[model samples]
Target: MQQDAVIIGGGFAGLSAAYILARARRHVTIIDSGTPRNRFAAHSHGVLALDGKSGLEILADARAQLAAYPTVTFLNGEAHAAQGTIDDFHVDVAGHEPITTRRLLLSGGIEDRLPDIPGLTERWGKTVLHCPYCHGYEIGGGPIGVLSTQPMSAHQAAVVADWGDVTLFTNGMPEPDEETLALLERRKVSLQPGTVDVIEAGTCDRLRVRLKNGRTFDVKALFVAADLHRRGTIAESLGCTLTETPAGMIIATDTVKATSVAGVYAAGDNARAFGNITLVSADGVMAGLGMHQSLMFSGHS
Candidate 1:
């Protein structure tokens, strides 16, 4: 049986799109492996009304609400492969029958590649965070550490300074040039040229940052600019266009969330570089609209 649409990844973006399609009386199937990008975080922030709720909790509630629509079907598994053209896509699942759909949405999201530092990975989403707007208010205005992962870390430190006192640790990067140093001085962002040896849980909700030189600093929280990568190969397998961003490459899409390939769309972190809960939800909405519009008009002429 051919579905109106097959959405890969059942996170906020995919679920939001599914809701839209379901409301329109279209048959939609969502394939999700059950792991979300923000699963490591205890509570999600930046979204109105539902602030501080765990991502999983919000998703659970969403799933329950989506159950009201008979047009939506849920498949709790991964999409192993996707092939075929617009209006004739065959998606092979891990342990289920393949699905045929008129339109495809890629919302597999992205994965964060944390720096190779001890104690940091264990504290991710807690003591070690990525977004200031999401976790800064809870962290309060205290001492904060920024571990440099790429050239963008300098700008990241400057932005994080708006939340707390910031120290940019240039783990292995070369020291900033003269002009860059001047900007850091103006922003009051301190530079730690020492290579970080380890990160440890400190007293009073802080992290102990130990330098390879044996010097240490205790900070209320540590901010890191982690490298982001797309989670799966479904988009590439279908020959969708990928756009390069400072963090990584994401699926390229037009304003309506339609990708370069006809009958295909992308949403969530996989489609855009910058995202929080609200933005990805918006992506889902646009993708839903784009897919539905295409489905309605494609048969004309």
Candidate 2:
């Protein structure tokens, strides 16, 4: 009826926290809504030791390994609301009984908001992608395109240029600064100053970009630095302050992953500016260890 921690997600962050807490002989329950941000990504890369595997495969392996721990439970449900202080938290999941825990870890991750280009959404995570570290190697040395949605899109294009021939499409956004323009010219990255109407991809993996000015460019991959937002509404309800990053405003937490709200912690994409899988997992470990130490110091264990 009682648990040491309730993790409100099932992604790399929540799984890592639950695994660590369970190993410490703590009762931990992870409530997930069965949707991860990387679901659309066919293969997950850049994570050490498990590179180039499907996101589902990595999660399945993690779940299988965590099943051996007796203190961990996975609930296929969403945490609708949370109540009580840190030492005593009550979580309500839709269509399920409420769960009580001594601490709460929120790793609900974020949602990526892509541009309104006609075919870009459909090709997301496959032909139209983000994060060079995650998908760059797979599409390396190929003709790549970067769709400009924000000011940072130029920077993303510059970094991704190292892996392929780069093209920057200003999708109704302003032009870059003099320095940026010079860099693009020096790097031989073409700049298309027009709105993108759609992205066309064939079954054979050929990708094409159609511009509003009746221009089309051939490319194998497209990089979009989409906007990000928290997937859950619980953080704001709990009065957790958010700090703005290049992607979005993530829940502000200290080095140990403790949020402003005492007794509640955050990890993964929800708490970190750079929300890579490896970084998120490390944040979860730190939060879990910190929670355990707090419990031990309070003589709660």
Candidate 3:
């Protein structure tokens, strides 16, 4: 099959891009595996006007709205490999047929690498979350715990302290410097210096954090500094340059979402220095517009 643009991934970024491109009269096909990084998340927050809606609910609403546009199609498959060049990109979807497009938008997003502790993975996006902006308000002004799994976890703890009574669980990590320690002390954030054994659901949907010392802490929520990985392998195989930053390793993109490779654009967590639901959606919109403009200038749109 052939189209004007092929968007890989079906999260907020891919859907938003498809919506915009379809509205602009472009024949766009979104290839998605239907497993967004936020699938584990119960609700999406920090999105303007839709702050506290479930991730599935928001996507369903978006899909219903985009259904009005006839130029758009959704394929529930993964784009395994992409070849060819600008104005003629060929994408291969695993277990399906290949497709050709004039341009490509990758909104593949990323996955959070949670700690090895038991129950953390199962509780991810529910009791265990990452971004304070996204899940903090829902758990506002309660006993919140931050699991220090990365070097920057102390900073995360400091940030979450603004919302509620905070506790920093070192989880075997070294103590922070005097400056960092002072900051925590000044903020009245408690410190737990031991490895976490497990996290289990407690009374009233709270989380019970069990440390190695057999001590337990009942928290309204827990924030973990999880390592993130790009959701798709196609980008790396296609020669897209990945860069490491304080936030994490992500695909490098310019102001317009153009990647290191021409004819390819990246959006969402894959391209963002800081990943958030609202920001990812906005980035997708911008990348869609940029891709559209590129196509128009080249006389393909």
* TM per prediction: 0.97, 0.96, 0.94
Give a tens-digit lDDT track for model 2, residues 13-108.
888888888889999999988788889998888889888888878988999999899988989988889988877889999999999989899998
**Strongest candidate by TM-score:** 1
Worst 10 residues of 3 by lDDT: 225-234
Worst 10 residues of 2 by lDDT: 198-207
Could you list the CA RMSD of all candidates, in the order they appear? 1.3, 1.5, 1.7
Better of 1 and 2 by TM-score: 1
Residue-pair clashes per prediction, in order, are: 0, 0, 0
lDDT of 2: 0.86
Candidate 1: regions farther than 4 A off: none
Clash pairs, candidate 3, are: none
**Pairs of residues at least 3 apart in sequence or in different chains that clash in candidate 1:** none
lDDT tens digits, residue span 144-202, model 3: 99999877889899999988999999999999899999988988889999999999987
Tell me the tens digit of each residue's lDDT in model 1 across 1-301: 8999999999999999999999999999999999999999999998899999999999999999998999999999989899999899999998898899999999985788899899999899998999999999998888999998888888888899988899999999988778778888888999998899999977886899999999999999999878888876888889999999888899999998998888899999998888999999999999998888888888730
Go through the candidates in order and give each one's C-alpha lDDT. Answer: 0.91, 0.86, 0.86
